[model samples]
Target: MTAQHPSDVDLFAPPRRSGPRPTTTGREIPHDQLDQFSPPRIRAALIGHATALPGVFTGPSQVSEPASLALRLHDPRGRWEAFLYPSPDEFGHIHRTGFMHLTVPRPIIAPLIEAGWIEPHPITLRPQWPDTIVMLYAPRDEDELALATAIMDASWQQATES
Candidate 1:
């Protein structure tokens, strides 16, 4: 009997795509199209606020999948504060998903999950950050963005203060 390869199994797992994941649709959206996938205005505001924070650097996520264009927030001490990226579904559709991923504290994760604001990361996909991260659902308005931002801020505070 021939040995089964890893790729030949796990049909239930999320499909992995090559190249940079698109912010919306299968293609990369322009910088101005940030709002299309989620709340456009809120997305811009959140990004602006994060970038303006002291010691926070906004750039592509270093720890994410290759060619991912996630907006990574780094603390003053050079630690990762959070990551904001389009949440892809199992089929790999990046556009119109309206969800986002954030890395935050374990203590606050439960409430977010319970409130339907976020969901726990899949252990199989992110074993490294299982208990410490949550996927922020589509923040379609300012209120949602506010909550997401607050969590991100807390993540920064936790990373820096510890």
Candidate 2:
């Protein structure tokens, strides 16, 4: 066998043109354009329903608990249970260079406190995703529901924009 020089080896080559290109534009046709990108619509069904009070705004989407952590909201009288399902972006935030913390507007939180939806509970770490919060509310506490709705709506809105 003959010894081969390292520089003689072809370590890298241009990517092979495997698929057909447009005759006119010379651009590859995206597969999604032909098939129409569609997936089964799966929705989160609310197991325990909570209502926001009148005059509170409701945007689309339900607030579900993140799988990593369970939230139990407490008041002077008792405790309320909630589950959490965090979004992918939340994971992205926690993995960043520094610890990221999200502050819920006081305007939103104060009303829920006064209405007995939540108390002065310690801010729960958002599981593996540090950008979210969770809660369980009593019936017709509109403010809390609206806040939850707003969060979900904002997430969906951001998702669509990109």
The TM-score, computed over Cα atoms with residue i paired to residue i, of candidate 2 is: 0.24
Model 1 / residue 124 / CA error / Å: 6.5
Listed in order, each prediction's TM-score against the native is: 0.56, 0.24
Per-model CA lDDT versus the true structure: 0.44, 0.23
Question: Can you write out model 1's per-residue Cα lDDT over 1-162, one digit (the tens) per residue?
Answer: 122222342222212222233332322122112322456676666566566555655444443443333443333332333332222211011123345555566666666555555555553244443355455555556555555556556655654453
Q: Which candidate comes out best when scored by lDDT?
A: 1
Q: Lowest-lDDT window of 10 residues in candidate 2?
A: 91-100
All candidates: CA RMSD in angstroms? 15.1, 23.7
Query: Candidate 1: lDDT over CA atoms?
Result: 0.44
lDDT of 2 by residue, 1-162 (tens): 122222232212211112232122112111011211112110111111111212122222222212211112221111111112232222111101111112223344445334433222223432342222322221122332233334333322233232
Candidate 2 total steric clashes: 9
